[model samples]
Target: MKFCYKNGILDWRIVVLVFLLYLLHALTVKILVVASIIAICESGILLFLALKRRLDLYLYTLVIILATTFEFPMFVDESLKFVPSIIMLPLISGYFFLLLSLWPLPKMLGNGSIWKTISKKFPFLFSFVSITLVLGIVMGVLSLFTDSTSKTFHFSFFVKDLMILGVFNVYALYFMYSSLIYPQFKQKLELIIFSVLVAMILAALFVSLVGAKGFYGTNEIMLMPLSFFFSTTIVFFLFYKKYSNNHFVLLIFLSCITFFMQFAYSNALGGKSWLVFFLILMTCLIFWYKRAKLKLILGSIVVFLLFPFLLNIVEKKTDGDSLSSSKLVQALSLVSVVDVDWYTNLPLSPKIRIEELLNTNLEFVKHPSFALFGKGFGGGHQDYRYAYGGYNPAAFSLEEYNNEYFIRMHESVNTIFLKFGLLGLVLSGTLLFRHCLVCNKSPWLVLGCLWFVFFWGYSSSLMSIGLSSLFIGIEDVRDK
Candidate 1:
């Protein structure tokens, strides 16, 4: 993969430069507009060169960089106004990337004949991209008729899921082409990964000291520094697990403990005790599988049983609620397929969090049309603030409500229902279960890394996008 810079100037430097400008945007408040201007200009030039060469990779990178950097942090006013145009660029770019990357496959698999595709060796990759893209487009068009506070948000997220799908395909295609065809491209991945890790550490530190008071605030900052270390640990565990690497194991242990301590004691995201437990259990399971020792299994079971006790101690010291009193069980209880009317008239409990899910789902299936098409992206939650008491747009703000209720639909499965109705639910649900149901090396590793991502999606939309990309990149190959 020796990049011919003399003939066609696309290389690692372009990727690094764009990411640096994005970091600058995230760090300095005043540099947002200026950084975007420079990055977008560079992207335009790259896109022009890519078109001349007919290389879709450059266009793919262009769209992802745009989408990744333009994190619409806040909404301006009654209307999103200029915000919609800015955000839409990424979605539109992402759609083109999808088409460029995987087109005729959709045409062949358009009918109910997708089972043939799912039966392949690498079914996870093919099934996820095909199903999500087809269903997402159908639901996006259908959702346009539904009322929403902002059309920009509605349109952008309508196709937002495609961005992740596109990323997966583009990345896989890049690695395949580089490995089999060019071979030199493999070296470039290491450079990109190393640069990203270094930049994330520096940016995380800078943001903690100076940028905490902004929109992301203190709680996010507490977890910021762990990104680089955690990412590096996962990379090494996946790639270098065959060799003797006690240091990697130590790093993983420290990362888990540090992540738990920071989030637990800081009174940040404390209500998500279920998620914390699930993560701890998954981590233990991964390490235990890697070692396959009886002591590890017994020790994991002990810790699993005592997790609530540990949470109790942590909560008492921090003046937070105990995990035993959490609504996790109640939320899980609503997973059955009951009548809509039954869920609607159910009495509210200590919190209306689960009730909100029931009511929204009822609203979704109340009518045949609504049940078929759904209210679109950014729809289904206009009056959610009333049910949850009040909405707090800021993280860790004084306004005391489950801020997650603002975007999350209690369950990602149900969220799919609210977005694209029964059809969408079936498609996404199939992708979720069938892809990773078999516990192979690649699939298992992806599950370990992203179990919490999918689980948390049931409670919030946090990892629904960013971390989901990791699942697609994992392979059974050791070198990857």
Candidate 2:
């Protein structure tokens, strides 16, 4: 197959045709017409790319398969209503596109010394396995006692989810280890970027379909992992690539756009704490500007900080307080409150919250009698009632707060700790710390990775599929 980009091979005419076809399909209400057009477009792209021997095309196909596989199971259960497969389908597609762009690979130059050093440290793999085994034993024991049908198990769902989560935890560890030791930055970045774009497109489509529901309600949370991947990739790109003044300006503009988009979505859909998200981004920008004094960074920060305040003032003057209670404004207010609360109650020491969170997870710890090595996959209770009292704890509940702290406490912090315990937490933390260390050697990369890590902590579990791709991508960039 020809790998060359021949002249006229990708003409503007073909592009326009594809766009028109897509536009028409989107405008039409006929279900069959839309489906047929989508299938044709997707298939045509695949066929064209394949005929041209563009293996890069496989990235999209892989996303479709992976996203469908991951989400299809949810639809199978008749009891589970409100499945948003439409949103997931496009998200998966966008993720694949992003992955294609950010995969990393080490420079194939004089790097024998680095390879030798990696070879010497190879024994860490065994150490990681041993640690995982110990944690597995602990989890097995906890599962037995907590999951004994006779016992009044409040968190039995933890045990069931643990088995699935445990496997992924191990996979995540191995991925990190491979990333660190092998250091295939180029390949990983490409994969990560590809996955992120696919995820983003899907997320946008999903949110649109769900009439702009909150993050969790529209299953927008799934996109967080993908967002981490792309944001980090962009940061890495800016750090490594030689940039002109124009490029730097563009970067600032893009960041501003992203900040506003997230804010708008948070307001329109009651999913995330918009204020917290904005504050985090603002804080990062402020620190970046203060430390570097780069005009682009400084300008972006100033604009972002002042934009909301100015908007608020204008709204109050024009619309009055009652009329100014727009969804976006309300979301922004919520975010502000949550961010203030988090910092105000910040833990005094390192690992303090994680440690405390682990203790709560001890309720799920079982005895060795249940299984010394560990309960095999899917060994815990399958009942949703056992998990969160028949309530989707991750979902918004009027009974509790909708801030990041509560979300962390319920969805990510407690979930991982309960299932994988200390080992998982340590390994996950180590992987992130390593990524930070690698990227930190360069300021631009460091800033990018930091942005991703912050969002990852706030929105999703470290072991999640999207987060995994993110780490892999960052690791890839570092290798390069």
Per residue, candidate 2 scores C-alpha lDDT tens digits across 1-480 of 122221211223322332343233223312334544454455456555545543333333433322322122121222333222222223343233222222222221245564444434433333433465456556555554555343323233233333334333343343444444443432433343333333443344443455532243333322222232233223233443343232565445444545545533332122223343544566557667767858768677676667558556745764622221343344444334335454343322212334435434433343333332333222232221222232443332322222111112333434434435555556546655655556534433343344333332222222233434544445445446
Q: Which parts of model 2 are misplaced by more than 4 Å?
A: 1-130, 133-138, 146-164, 170-236, 242-257, 267-411, 441-480
Residue clash pairs of candidate 1: 1-184, 1-185
Residue 6 of model 1 has an lDDT of 16
Candidate 2, residue 437: how far the Cα is off, in Å: 2.6
Off by over 4 Å in 1: 1-23, 49-128, 139-281, 285-299, 320-356, 369-386, 394-411, 438-440, 443-480
- For candidate 1, lDDT tens digit of each residue in 392-426? 44321121233232334544555556655676666
Model 1's alpha-carbon lDDT is 0.41
Query: Which of the numbered candidates is closest to the native, going by highest TM-score?
Result: 1
* Model 1 vs. true fold: TM: 0.58
lDDT, residue 409, candidate 1: 52
Question: What is the Cα-based lDDT of residue 123 in candidate 2?
Answer: 31
**In every candidate, how many clashes are there?**
2, 41
